[model samples]
Target chain A: MNSMKGKPMNHKKFEQMILTPEALTSEEREELARHIATCESCRKLSLQWQKASRMLNKPLPMAAPAPGFSARFAHSIEKRKEAEQQKQVRRFITILLVSLLSAALIFAVTYYSTNSLETIIKDTANASAQMLFLWESLKAIISTVTGFLPTVLLIPFLLTAASAMLTLTLLWLVSIWKLTLQKETVL
Target chain B: MEHELQQWLDEAMQGKEESFCRLVDHYQNGVYNLCYRMLGNRHEAEDAAQESFWRAYRNLHRYDPSRSFQTWLLSIASHYCIDQQRKRRMTLIAIDEPFEETFGSNSPTPEHVYSNNEQSSQMEELINTLKPTDRAALVLRYWHQMSEKEIADTLSLSVSAVKSRLFRARKELAEKMETRREEYELHERETYEPQKI
Candidate 1:
């Protein structure tokens, strides 16, 4: 059926309106009623929707779990808690073993690579001298940098810069940790 | 009652097992109903409901207090059932097969057959034919009386998507029900033809 404006009433639009007639504007509903009054197909669809809507309104039978459901659920919760605890213990043990093995591997590689105690002592002395030279260079560089700025201003600036750098570093590390954890979960 | 549930939720969050159990006792039926409707079977529904609860318990910290807890639980159940349905479709089961299969060749008893035929309404049977997401949308919309926005939130779809799917689901269901009604009438006439003679 065509509306008074001569446009055919689309079945799809009418079906949608039948499903949710309350959504229709009053004018659209009046037009729909006029069309349904004349259109046999749309009227049949409208009745079918009414029956379907009634079917939807009927009470659905509620299904309950078998007896002992709550008890079984509580038991499952307990089992989960135990499993999580066991997992934590296993993780701690694994971490401890890994740390000890890593320390042993480092010690073995260091002791075997160095020739003897005398060589080890010589290497330690050379390392200490290098550190002392590095400290002297750092002191010289600091004196040079202080030439243009007051010590008070320089200290606060360095502290602020250090804090900002630390914060950025922490944030980067956190992001990487989160990314890796996410990857593990996805895998 | 909602405030009571919120109080129980708070206690459960505090590691009180009894409070959690009370919450379970209260919402178990709702969760089970959603699962059974989505899965169309009892055993799978039970497993899915249990799994949903387990997941919810483990991820309780992620539950936002501002939203409805029932919706959160139903979302988990719907997602699990939808995933299972996807896996089930991957295996390619025939549409005409009985809802459940036992190991033996024994046929279903007469009582089982009758009850099975009677329990599934034409609407629900037609609904079972829909895609998992669409089925979830219709169930949440009609059975649960959820608004379109809530259905969208639960199904992780947009509101317009939910509206469109609901419209499509109802249309499809109406078409299927009409076909079934005609088939039933034809069968009745065929059975009555011999008696008429």
Candidate 2:
């Protein structure tokens, strides 16, 4: 309130304006000015605030980030990208190994089944009837071993490799999930 | 584009690389200055500034665009800095040692020390000694010239809280300055009073 007008401004609010720098609205500025003219304490604080403004406004030198900061930051980002690629590469290798192991296991199964005694005896009888049958049997076995077995071997091997890979991928995903689930990180 | 910045910032909250880098560059100096003034150590300031931005980036969605961007961001940095100070003070107390001092039992008193250039530095050092929250209220209000409302918004405090702090800080600074002035007068009287008599 304007004292001369037989009213009063809120002393608390005027003091707040002194504490808060930056321009108050024109109406606020006028009110504060009128209040300060009548209020010695507010007037003194206003002067102190002016000095504070001048000191701070002189513009102290603020240091920038390191000269190569952006570049170094980019470098770190690249480093992280490389680490991720390396992790992916490790995963791919693990899958490859599992696939090869599964292939070996399937090969073991085929070897036992086709090389059974019953099957060999039947083949021998057939060979007795045909003079060239033994040669044909050996050729058939060689072809099956070389051509069909490896492919058959690959089927289970690929599945094993793929399944293991999927499991590992899920584990990696789970760790990241746990990381995100964490509360109260520094950032 | 400004709104897009806001949108990008929102997306960035989800950990968008592009927005993080962009926002970092956009406000690095402002953020760095706030941290530097808050911490009073270059290295710590750098770390604080970096971490504050990362935190803001991590929690960008929580930012209210209805508020000024800089004020909102400064608020985050202020909290980060305050937390650091609390941790530092706790750690310092835990270790149990006084900060280095030029005054010793044989050394000149604060009155004598006031005559030297060290006085200004000492005053600055003393200012830095204030709790981070108090120092922040002082720095942002005096140094950055933020409005009380802006500061309140920045710190997530009510406007009255900001005003109360500012008032207390002023009274505190004045009291310290007043005490130092008295000490200097006492020293002058001791050194010259006998001769005058």
Candidate 3:
């Protein structure tokens, strides 16, 4: 506040002038001068701001880049560009090979198939069911043998199995959480 | 001079590598120094400066000729440095470490090491305490002498945002300087008091 006129000038406005005096118009400069001349607080603030501005303007000790920085930088850019082109070429080749292999596989499958699609699918399904049945019978036999053991031993075995499954599940959840965090950071 | 520079820019836009190299030679010092100030390290600054130029080259087509090219280039440098600071969290500057040990430590010329004044070094350390964006704003304004508008354009921010960041940074530095000054005064009084007794 200019105590003389009871008009307040914000310190920020005064600071802006100190930082960039060229920004002030002639009339604003006159106003600022009159305020500083009359307002003790504003006068002190102006001096402090001017000192801060001078400190900011002090010459910085700058170090140049290592010798041949530009040449090395250009070389790195060229190397990166070349690497990108090579990556593209590799990608194209992989796509072409995958397409060709798929086409060949389709051709072979169609040429070899004398049965209808429905019959083939049905036969495959039946084979899978028979294998599942065999796996179930093997599990039944193992259980029957383990069933012969004492109940006390069987309880511990079951408890161990449960704890192992729980550990595995927790580890899986942690790994998934880590992966999601990594993906978020990358994005 | 700007007309001649524009001619080079036109050639560079047309894929004239030599013309682009000329641009690199012309502005490398400023770009490197900006990166150095922003990152507070030499090797990273060099890396950032180089990456900025490469990005500028790749995106030269998107550059608006109506804007200043130097500002555009510096914008790239500051943005890259800001991201690097974010990822690396480079808040601590190992200034006292020897130059060979640290990528951009103050070089150990006997004169530079022995003759270093406390105030400027303190100022440098205080600047490192700022957030990456605020530090970049201060560097662009004070070191590069960029106008507020230029800083705003370079950082892709509004002018008021740039001003606020500058104000916040300066406020923080001033507070630190005040504390340091008080500490020095206290030390001086203690030493003189013992001698007087």
Regions of model 3 farther than 4 Å from truth? A1-51, A87-187, B1-4, B97-118, B181-197
Return the TM-score for each candidate structure. 0.63, 0.49, 0.61
* lDDT of model 3, residue B125: 68
Predicted candidate 3 versus true structure: per-residue lDDT over B1-197, tens digit per residue? 77878888999999987778778877888898889877767778888888999998889999999999999999999999999989987676755633222214546576655434445555666787789999999998887888989999999999999988987777666556666667867977988989988
Question: Per-residue CA lDDT of candidate 1, range A1-187, in tens?
Answer: 4443576657777778877786999999998898788877778778777767767765545556766666778889978877886686677557655755665465446444634567557656775786688669767866787788786588555545445544554454455445545654676
What is the i-RMS of every prediction? 5.8, 7.3, 4.7
Q: How well does model 2 score by local distance difference test?
A: 0.64
Q: What is the TM-score of chain B alone in each candidate?
A: 0.80, 0.69, 0.81
Model 2: per-residue lDDT, tens digit, A56-106?
444344446655544444445656656766687678778777866665466
- Looking at model 1 chain A, report the run of 10 residues with the lowest lDDT sum: A169-178
Candidate 2 per-residue lDDT, tens place, B1-197, comes to 67777766776667777766776777777777788767766677677876676566556778776777778778888999899888877311121222222233565555754443334333445467566687888778755778888888878789888878877776555445545546757887899999998
TM-score of model 1 relative to the true fold?
A: 0.63
**What tier of docking accuracy does candidate 1 attain?**
incorrect
Error of 3 at A65 (Å): 1.7
Answer with 1 or 2, whichever has the higher lDDT: 1
In angstroms, the error of model 1 at B21 is 1.5
Local error of candidate 1 at residue B106 (angstroms): 37
Q: What is candidate 1's lDDT per residue for B1-197, written digit by digit as tens?
A: 88899999998878787888888888888788788778877778788988898888888888898888999999999999999999888322223433432223554687965554443445556778888898989888876889999998898899999989988887777666678778867887998989999
